[model samples]
Target chain A: MPHDHHDHDHPAHSPPQPDDKVHSYYQILGVALKELLIEKGIVTADEVRSAIEKRDQITPAHGAAVVARAWSDAGFRTRLLTDANAAVAELGYPMTTTRLVAVENTADVHNVVVCTLCSCYPRELLGLPPAWYKSRAYRARIVHEPRAVLAEFGTQLLEETEVRVHDSTADMRFLVVPRRPAGTESLDEAALAELVSRDSMIGVAVVRQP
Target chain B: MRGPHDVGGLDDGPIDPAPHELGFWEKQIDGLRGVIGAKVIVTTHENRRYVESLGDDAYETLTYYERWTAALSRQMVDKGLLTQAEIDARVRVVRERLAASGELAPGAEDVKP
Candidate 1:
């Protein structure tokens, strides 16, 4: 007889408790599975830890700093607009094979990025993704109704401002270099970086004068 | 199959301005994912493919790290790096220990891996 013991009458596990605080079955499973992988020597705990540390190194501030420099130095902005990967590397931000694309927002144009396939962002530069970026609602709606979504984010574009939404469907990740607000001609690069919020880099909002 | 994860241009709701605090296990899973990919065991494409094959409900309901780990387990088993029996044993032990300690619901003791 063929060894069919694999399907032995093991009972089903009930779904997670409705206690609301209980970890989901999948979450618990993840913990156990990760342990097994580590035990088997397929990967080291230090490797995973280093990967996490690398992610923690980047923040919205890194992306903001780049945007700030672009604001103060037209040359950098032009280079960023032309070759974002090189421009970001010039700033000593970690570089990988994934291409970085910086889209500039001008008076007549507003750009927003949404990945329809997955929640891919400029992770190497902006660190981890936000909850909303991974939410089904945001992913499904942003591509079609970017204007409405931006409004929800409290970003209202001028009627004349063209809403250009970029669907990051390829290997390229996008960073929106929002237009500098007026009355900020005196602000230096460091001060300008402080004004660049995470959402602004994501293109859901614009950089405003403090 | 057109997975729910491919949702784009579909209407939803407002973004919660609140920040998300990653749970302990989430951090581990995400890091493990990076290490796994760095090892070239599974590419992002393969991971996405596994995620999409998890059926629409699991894909939609599972948290980001949950899906990543699930797909990872799937790939590890597929690649012969680990066995389902070993994984099931560990999962069962974890559930029992937690359930016994009241960390998990008491009824979870009867759960089959």
Candidate 2:
């Protein structure tokens, strides 16, 4: 009875809201002091730096390659749509944490991803998510009004593409593998990578012709 | 302390908290610190008068920060900056150094107990 009363009183006396500013990305990704010391023993600072650089260079290209292949190869597209993890690995970007879910932006429903629980991004393929992608405004609004959220990012989907909001919970994360843009029929893998921004993969932006 | 996930509709604005560019693990640590700080101050203030009504239990209830600091020290150790032995040694040294200097209050060292 006492515990129940405590729980009841909790909601009635919650504090006023806090600030809306997001934490800085560098502060977010910086190694803990302990980890930094441990890392010095295990690997050189230069080595760690090089590893990060290589990871950054490869993942976006790898993701674009998958998108390009998916555009051309029917079987690969099927595999990507059906099993995003295996498809991503097939293209050589094997992400350990994120569970890849390709939300097809079609004439019907367009899928957008937001981690209401935490920032569960597809870093293995897309690299780091953009600053706005992780903002409190984006996280809270995307779920309720996907179209308006997308509009803020300068992405105006056709009215036909019904906005389907996907929230990343504790266990699983999602990525939106947007429908390949039209007129990109002739572009190569390298060219395609230029068009695939991190925001696009989150379903907030779309690849447009240059 | 507020949970990282509890920042929605904050500051009377509709904007979402921008995601910091840090990697997942780093963000978790920051979130942990925020949560702990929020919990301690809120709890202490909320129960201050209640503790005055029940002296010993109130003191016991106010030991939240001690538990959190201990957990944070353990986390630092687990992350590999310090060994368990080092943390224990550091805690002992800090206690002794403080006590020898008369910095320890009448019951401060007994907070953990």
Candidate 3:
């Protein structure tokens, strides 16, 4: 589950809300391009509408389910680590654009993903990436100092624990399967999935049972 | 030796980590990119290349989707999918309608067509 997640309860931060009253050059351009394309019969209006609807349906929960399954089943975890794309597809969450690489977080090593060039993300399973993921500070500094970035997210790792950062590219994406919290072995898959957050899947925050 | 977009390992400022709800236009632009990619009108790589080529100025000034909108406009022209004149004309029409309905931003008209 590298791409989209449908759940809207983002972990943290409050971004400025878009003002519908103001329309800009690019906004008008976006509208015009879609209209012109539809006017020319290149694509139907219905098609574009449907595409928007479909995008809205995907969210981080999709990735959480995948992580939960991997936590509960060792065989599935093996398959997920071996062939993440096919493993997710078997769960009915197929990769639409890029190849998915599920990186597991062990007690000795923690993994995180970022796109240094641009906002390359697993949009299918993780839904849209958070604005912070696209910010210059996070992009530039994460690779340089992941522990600091992780600390900002309130994730503190032991000194001996290794931090591995994966830079997502145009053709490939990364999803982090966080180590399940202790004392959660009695929980079912559904309950386990509830504990996985978007930030955890992005490797910014670790999964913690409440 | 780094491109404007190659910001990894730079001593940039602290991350805000704020998550804002996307605007309608932002989401629309994203959907347009998705649909256009599905149609094979433009490859995702091409879009990334175009956005990366937007230089330091645009990368600094525009928001995420604004960069995509601007780059997509350039790609459409370069690919001959649409003419600049046609885009401008449609924009003018839409702008006029919005203006008439008093929906334009307070000083959005200050920007050139």
Candidate 4:
């Protein structure tokens, strides 16, 4: 492997040791660029801080809200699948200009997302992707071996089921709306939304009954 | 511009199923770039192209946000916000301050191929 998945011998995600002053070029570059931009009056520090916080606040729950609503309301589902940008906006998510495509995972078919080029995700809807979602392993393998990768994520499909991989790009993002699990008819919209996990929405796993 | 970063459908290593929580510095980089990108000074397309042009080694060594930060720096410099010399000087200063403050990360200067 040309790349070391482990970062700088820090035991898998250990807290930054106190002497962590040695900065990578990116960190230095980030600080430098931020400083210059601020000095140039191009952007304010508070502006950047708030933007990050907003973006960081997005989670699968946002997507789950949409999905759970869709499950209860067929009209909303049609709107989401037909025009994701407008539908998501109705719920207050301002997405990129790139269109969002909602792929339905039915009994015979499944769906997943990846940006084979460089991790182009729907940040407005799903927040930032996981590290593995952007890994060389996933970008390379998921499209070709969707079943195998899905297995790794604990998603086992029936022999008759079909797996579909959505290749995200700069112009489009794919969101998987997994099938509504069984035995939850009595559950309310909020409760149903709680059953939807990020992994399930990513098409790597199924929403489980609770 | 086409290289290893475009790894869709290629065989590679195992997926780390860990939850990738962003740290403060990572959030700062994202925040900074997000603010800059919003100004229309540098489009997301241009920034992504810059990141892809970083070659396989740096792309592999750096984390996702690190690449974003590096590419943001390059684009900012290219966009006339900073000269290469100016940013270089700033990097040096950051290093000194960090070292003096006992936050000096060891071997951070080494960029291995």
DockQ of each: 0.44, 0.09, 0.53, 0.56
For residues A45-132, could you state the per-residue lDDT of candidate 2 as single tens digits? 4444444565456445566677777777889889988988888888777755446777777667778888653355676676655555
Q: Which portions of model 1 miss their true places by more than 4 Å?
A: A1-22, B100-102, B105-113
Off by over 4 Å in 2: A1-32, A35-55, B1-4, B7-74, B77-113
What is the docking quality class of candidate 3? Answer: medium
Identify the candidate with maximal DockQ.
4
The positional error of residue A151 in candidate 1, measured at the CA in angstroms, is 0.7
Number of the predicted model whose lDDT against the real structure is largest:
3
Candidates 2 and 4, the one with greater lDDT: 4
Write model 1 residue lDDT over B21-95, tens digit each, in one string: 676667778888888888888777788788778766566545677677778878889999988898778888887
Clashing pairs in 4: A21-B103, A21-B104, A21-B105, A22-B104, A22-B105, A139-B8, A140-B9, A140-B10
Candidate 2 CAPRI classification by DockQ: incorrect
lDDT of each: 0.77, 0.53, 0.85, 0.79
Report how far off residue B68 is in candidate 4 (Å): 1.7
Listed for every candidate in order, the interface RMSD values in angstroms are 8.0, 13.9, 9.1, 4.6
Per-residue alpha-carbon lDDT of model 1 for A1-210, expressed as tens digits? 121232322121223234533355556677677788889898887898899888778788999999999999989999999999999999988557578899999888998888788777888778887877767767788888888888889988778889988877436799999989898889999999999998998899888778
TM-score of each: 0.88, 0.57, 0.93, 0.91
> Residue B5 lDDT in model 3?
87
Could you give candidate 4's per-residue lDDT for residues A63-178 as a string of tens digits? 99989988999998999989988888887886767889999999899898888887788888788888788777888999998988888888789989988888987888888998
Worst 10 residues of 4 chain A by lDDT: A10-19
For candidate 4, the share of real interface contacts preserved is 0.69
